[model samples]
Target: MREKLGKISNFLVSLAAGIASFVFTLVAVLVVTDFNEKLAASLIMGLFALLIVWVASEQPNSSQARAVSALIKRLLAVGSGDLTSPTPAAVRREMPALAAAVDNLFEQVRSNLDNVHAIALYDPVTSLPNRVHFKREADRVLKARGWDDGVALLFIDLDGFKEVNDSLGHAQGDQVLTMVANRLRIVVKAETREDSLAPPLLARLAGDEFTLLFPRVREPAEAERIAQSALVALCEPFEVGEQTIDMGASIGVALSPRHGTDLAALMKAADIAMYHAKESGRSQASMFHARMAAAFEEKVQTEKALREALGRSEFELAYQPQLDARSGVVVAGEALIRWNHPYDGLRLPDSFIGIAEESSLIVDIGDWVIDGVAATAARWHARGMAQRLTFNVSPKQIERADFFDRLRAAVERHQAPLRMLELEITETLVMKCGDRVIAELAALRAEGLSIAIDDFGSGYSNLARLKDMPLDRVKLDRSLTADVDRSEGALAIVTAVIHLIHGVGCEVVGEGVERREQLDLLRAVGCDVVQGFAFSEALAETEFLDWVRDNAPLRLLPRSA
Candidate 1:
């Protein structure tokens, strides 16, 4: 009886201790943990209860009792976060199902933790290390190296990615981004040194932007070589699904100690250099320089001013006369935009147009131009001037879904005749816009507006497709006409181009004519219209009207005489 009582007392004591532990762990887990953790806690409590029952039913020194005791000790260790503790083989043999369940629970918890860690550190779309991880890893490597050797950082930004997303769906865009990340990884991996203390690191900073870090770079030439490799890798066409997409990357290279010493500084330098690469042209790399920073500052200020210019009514138009080559008579004028900036004096399109185009501010500016030109054309028509006026169009303006409606509204609002106005589109824009643009242009033509291909011969265009366009005329770029008077080669090209335009039922306008020899050669080649400084430079609204009246004598003279 004494022995039985002692065994019973010892079992009660063990059961009480196990119950207290279960209660404490259960309270904590229920209060602060997730469903999985609560479930784990409940299973542990059940295990302890089973052990208590086993101890009460078994002999004082049985194998069951020993296994229960060992499992209780292991469970205690596990509850305190020591996952390395394992259920004894005796416990597994005695309670195979329960021991397997516990082991599976622990394995699942570990796998869940790994998944959470990856979600926090990597980009979900491309599976590349994100900005947070990139910064952390870059800082660690930079500190470990002690700044003994130079490091090169490249900031990569994709060009024309937005257009891809706009044309194709976001799903396709994600595929492009994934392919881009994989290619970048391959390029960096190929350049990685096998024995270097710090290998190259690559990360996706954000949408359409990535970074590459090269450690232990000894020369700028080495950095340049890697940058070129990256450019070439990205320049190749990416095949996504059934469609082939052409892409390009602009890279900015920044060297340690020269451009910056820390991650933030290096990022800023590399970013600025990348902007320079984009400005020079995409699909290239640019090195960090102090002047680039200054230029970037200027560009920012100019963009801000341009955005505000429309609101301030600081914009005006100047017209350069286009005369009939056969009659030597002023027949039309091309409208050019000018900004009368308050702080910078007068600024031409070359000084700020590219900046406007980049920010998409040109859309608003183009609207303003269209309204202003329509109003002016109305006034001209009211005064009996039937001569047509041409205005350049931007790709952004054409891309808007409501472009046609907005244009027609502007003309209707000004009560202007469509025949008195013409639209000029560049050759490159025409090619890029494809069939939709052709259909739109035909619709616009049906509405009585004339369409002209501007800057001809300056860009690539399929001659076979030229006949399909709704064009009234084709303007010869100054590049082709500048040397026509001096070079037979240039003159021959011009003559052939004129005949081609004629074949397509379109007249040819030779621009930038600054000399009699050039004019005579153009006239001899069957050019229809001429415009440049030789006749008149771009003039203000009032100056143009005055010059027109002043040059009435030259209007009737035949150039063929």
Candidate 2:
């Protein structure tokens, strides 16, 4: 207490002495000058006022106060992005507690900044750069490369990822994604290091999409080699939990100056090329070309048109007769979708169905078809028509958890023609469907909705899986019967398939029986039903009903007549 009082007393005395000296000096200066009497008086008064204000407001009373003032000035440097400035030693020595607190505050700020940066620029799940970070780095690399050097961008998309998610669940899907990112990093790192090239920038763009930037590659072959390595790395199965998942990637390569020198253009080209690789059969790489952009634009336009198609009511259904092999009576009419495009005239499903599925428009389109077919069946049943009506189902439609509910509602809304409605799905879909989907199909079947396998022999013929499904009929693919009348091998295979299907307690329907010989062959092989041009091409609703009424006893006769 005495020491503090003595210090304060001494400070006051010194301050008084300093003030007295400043006054004396100013008076001495005015006397020495003896010039400009009014100016000298004004200067003395101003000097005295400044001294008083300095002592009262600005001057620090002790070393601790001075240190704190200096420390605050230094800390405020943070506003200018100068977080790394060191604290003065004198300040540290004078007030260690405040110095330590400031240091801790700076540390917390830095840690928080790092976290924000990671969240902004890195994918949390894979810890790879996110889309924003990828684009920033890619732009930097492209700019640094200039016109002399060439760079390549690889846009990679995973194949069969949706199936993995649908069948195994999203948790397993995330595991697969993380493993994929790690494998890609390893492969890319290894290749770049082995070749002693500049390290490539890799990032997860979004779900199942990743990007790799090669900053120093000039040759397409080099990029191709890297893409192949990445593909081969992904070819190794990812073992997640009890499941060993086999996944593949399609990589698209776009070179700077060739595709485009900018980030947006390069990315667009690479994305288009990647889709081409995927469409041309996955597990490969495709280089960007001008033609791909055109096709991509066309597809974009088509997708846009398709989106408005349902709202515009531009879609309609045509029915083709499915006949009993012995009677040739129209047992069912396969409902096929037609787009009465205003500008393009009548368009087949082939013109837009692929786009519809890719853009997820199939779900809505599928719903529309279901409603249309149900209404048609109800109308036909009201008119005393006994034949069933069938329509194809898309995999995307079945992927929905509420597919059964929606379908049942549609049927009931149309007075419940569950007995006259048959749903056809591809054989591959039937085989690949998850247990939940299979159960739903069984539930629908139990509700008296017949399930038929469409294009049965088109893909992997897993008859065992087929038997496990609650299916009532299997329709042979057109390919299977394309030459069944001429080729003994085809006939034998068809006969075996029919018998196998029959063995599973499912009736066999032969598709594309356009010739009498084919019909005769199918019938001889014990095929229960046939449908093709041999009966009639798909007809409009009214035409179909008229044909059905006129040819109710339509006999199994050759089209040659």
TM-score, model 2 to reference: 0.87
What is the per-residue lDDT of model 1 for residues 222-323, given as tens digits with 9 covering 90 to 100?
Answer: 999999999999999999889999989999999997888899999999999999999897889999899998998999999999888988999999999998
Worst 10 residues of 1 by lDDT: 552-561
Q: Please give, for residues 442-471, the per-residue lDDT of candidate 2 as tens digits.
A: 888897889999998888888888779999
- Those runs of model 1 whose alpha carbons end farther than 4 Å from true positions after fitting are 1-120, 159-176, 236-248, 552-558
Could you give me the TM-score of model 1 versus the true structure? 0.79
TM-score of each: 0.79, 0.87
Off by over 4 Å in 2: 1-61, 87-91, 193-198, 556-561
Instruction: Show the colliding residue pairs in model 1.
Output: none
Pairs with steric clashes in candidate 2: none
